[model samples]
Target: MWYRLGQWMLRVILRVYHRAEVQGLDRVPRQGPFLLVGNHISYLDPFYIAAQLPQRISFMAKAESFSHPFTQWFLRKVDAFPVRREEADVRAMRSALARLRNDQVVGLFPEGRRREAEPPTELKGGASYLALRAQVPVIPVWIEGTDRALPRKGRWIRPAKVRIYFGEPIQKIPAGKNREDQERIHQMIMSAFRQLAEQKVAE
Candidate 1:
C-alpha cells in the first residue's frame, strides 16, 4: 500500500538526509484509537511524524493541499483527509469521529495551520473536542528543524537535522461537553505541547 511505502521511504529519506532523531516513541500506545497532537511548522510535518511511528496516523490536512488531482490521489493513498480551515467543518468532524470510533489514530495540529511563531498564538478546540467525544488519549508531539528543512515557501528540501519528541499520553480529559470542559481540555493539550517544546529548547 502507498501508506506503507510512503512511511518506509520517508524513514529512509529522513534518516539519510535530515538525520532525524526520535524520542519517547514508546510513550505511544501500541494499539487502539488515540489523538496525535503536534506543532505544525512545515508541510512535511505529518510525514515526518508518521515515519517514526509504528502505526498509521490519519492526519487532518488543510483543504487546499487536496486541490490538485495528483496531490488528492496521493493524500488519499496515505489516508489523510481534508479539513476546511476557514470555518467549522461538520463533515470533517464527523469523518474524524468515525475514524476514532474505528480505533484509528487521528492526528491533529491544534494551531490549525503551519506557524512560524514559537508557542502558538492561538489554539483550536477541535482536537480537545474530539478527545472528549471519543474519550481517547491525546499524545502531544513536538518536531524541530522541519521549518528549515522544508520551509513555508521553499522548493527544495535542504538537509537539516530534525528531532521529534512524543510526550506521555494525556487521558484525563474532564467528563463533559460544556464550553468549560472544552477549554480545560484544550489547555491541557496545549500545556503538554508547551512542555515538550520546552524540553526540546532546553536541550
Candidate 2:
C-alpha cells in the first residue's frame, strides 16, 4: 500500500540522513488509542516522530497544509487531517476522536503550531482536552535536534543528530469530572510536557 511504502521510505531516509536516536520507546503503549502529546519546534517534527514509531500515527495538521491538491493528497495518505486552527474546529475533533476510538495512535503538538526558537514554548490545552474526551492516556514525547536539521522556514535540511524521548503516559481524566477538574487536567498535561522537554534538553 502507499502508506506502507511511504513509511518505509521515511524510515530509510531518517536512518540515513538524520540518524535518529530514540530513547524510552518502551514507554509508548504498544497498543493504543493513546494521545501523543509533544512540543513542536520544526516543520518535520511530526514526520520525525512518525518515522520512529511503528504504529500508524495520525497528526492534526493546520488547514493551510491541505490547500494545495498534491500536498493534501500526500498528507491524507500519511494519516494527517487538517484542522481549522483559528477556532475550535469541532469537525476535526470528531474525526480525531473517531480514530482514537478505533484504537489508533493520534499525534498532537500541544503548542498547536510550530515555533521558530530554540527552547520549547508554552503549550495549548487542546492536547489535554483531546485526551480527556477520548478517555485515553497521553504519552508525552520530547524531540530534540529537529530544528537544527530543518530549521523553521528553512528550505535546506542539514544532516543532524535527532533524539526522541518517550515518557510514560499520564493518567486519564476521570469521567463525570467538573469544569474545574478539566482545567486541572489541562494544567497537569502541560506541566508534564514541560518537564519532559526540559529533561530532553538537559540530556
Candidate 3:
C-alpha cells in the first residue's frame, strides 16, 4: 500500500540523512483513539512522526494542502484530512472525532500552523477540544531540528539531525464541564508540550 511504502521511505531517508533520534517512543500508547500533539516547524513534521510511530496517524491539515488533485490523493493515502484553518471546519472536526472513536491516532499541531523558529509559540485550543470531546488521552511529542532540515520558504533540503521526544499522555478531564474546564485542559496540553520543548532546548 502507498502508506506503507511512504513510511518505509521516510524511515530509510531519515536514518540515512538526518541521523534521526527518537526517544520515549514507548510512552506512546499501543492502542490509541488518542490525540498526538506536537510542535510544528516544517512540512516534514507529520511524515516524520508517522514514520516513527507504530500506528497509522491521521492529520488535520490545512485545507489548502488538499487543493491539488495529486496532493489530495497522496494526503488521503497517508491518512491526512483537510481542515479550514480560518474557521471552525465542523466536518473536519467530526471526521477527526470519528477516527478517535474508532480507536485511531489523530495527529494535531496545537499551534495550528508551522513556525519558522525553534521553541514554537502558544498553541491553539483545538487539540484539547478534540481530546476532551472524545474523552481520549493526549500524547505530547516534541520534534527538533526540522526547521533546519527544511527551513521556512526554503526549497533546499539538507542533511540535518532530527530528534523526536514523546512525553507521557495527559489523562485528566472532567466530563460535561463548563467552558472554563475545557480551557484548563487546553492549557494542560500546551504546558506538557512546552515542557518537552524546554527539555529539548536544554539538550
Candidate 4:
C-alpha cells in the first residue's frame, strides 16, 4: 500500500517537475523474478525508476541510512532494504536472494555506489553474482539528465528533462572461470547501458 501510494505521488511530481520520458518498457519481461540494473547518476535514479514502473521493485539502500529512526521507517515504507557496501554483506545478500526466490524484481546499481563516471572503470559484481546464482535475466536500464536536476551535492533541484531507456535482458552468462565470468557479465551490462545512453543521445 505504501509503495503504491508513493509511486502515485512520485509519478505526479516527476511528470510535473522533470517532464521525464520513459522508453523500452515493453522490453521488460512480463513475469518471473528478474534483476533490474541501472547506472547510478543522482540519488533520484532509483526512486525515479520505481515511480515509472508499474510493479514493485526491491531496491538496496545503504545500511547507514537505516541507522536513523525516521530514515529507516521511511525506507521501510517504500519497501527498500539496506546493504552494506564496504564488504560482503551476508545479511543483505540473503535478503536479496530470498526476495528473488519469491519471484520478485530486485533493483541494483552495479557500479556499487553512486557515480557519475561514463564508461565506469570498475563495477561491483553484485548484479552478475545474483543473476548467475538466481538463474534469471538481467534487464539493463539507462537513465539520463538526472545529474542536472539533482546532483550528488546539489541542495536544490532544478527542473531538467530526464529520459530513461530500458534494454532487453541478458539471459545467459558464458561458462568459464568464476572471475572471468563475472567480469564478462559486468562488461555486458555496462555496454548495454552505454548503448541505451547513446541511443538516447541520437534521438
Best by TM-score: 1
lDDT of 4 by residue, 1-203 (tens): 87898899988877889898888899888789898999888888999998877788999989998999999998888779999999998888889888999999999897888887365667788888887777778999988888999888899888988888899789876655487887788788878877886787689
After superposing candidate 3 on the true structure, give the runs of residues whose Cα lies further than 4 Å from its correct spot: none
Local accuracy of candidate 2 as per-residue lDDT tens digits, 44-156: 88988887777889999999999999999989889899898888888988999999999999988877787753444466667767777888888888887788988876899
Off by over 4 Å in 4: 174-177
Top-scoring candidate (lDDT): 1
Q: Candidate 1: misplaced stretches above 4 Å?
A: none
Whose TM-score is higher: candidate 3's or candidate 4's?
3
Model 4 accuracy (lDDT, Cα): 0.85
Clashing pairs in 3: none
lDDT winner between 2 and 4, please give it.
4
Q: For model 3, how does the per-residue alpha-carbon lDDT over 73-141 read when each residue is reduced to its tens digit?
A: 989888899999888788988999999999999998988898755555577768878977999988999
At residue 97, candidate 2 shows an lDDT of: 90
lDDT agreement with native, every candidate: 0.90, 0.81, 0.87, 0.85
Q: Model 4, residue 61: what's the lDDT? A: 87
Ranked by lDDT from best down, the candidates are 1, 3, 4, 2
**Order by TM-score, highest first:** 1, 3, 4, 2
Report how far residue 55 has shifted in candidate 3, in Å: 0.9
Task: Report the C-alpha lDDT of model 1 over 1-203, residue by residue, as the tens digit.
Answer: 76788789999999899988999999999899999999999988999998887889899999998999999998898889999989999988999999999999999898998887376757988998999998899999999899999988899998989999999899997788889988888888888888988888899
* Model 3, residue 32: C-alpha shift (Å): 3.0
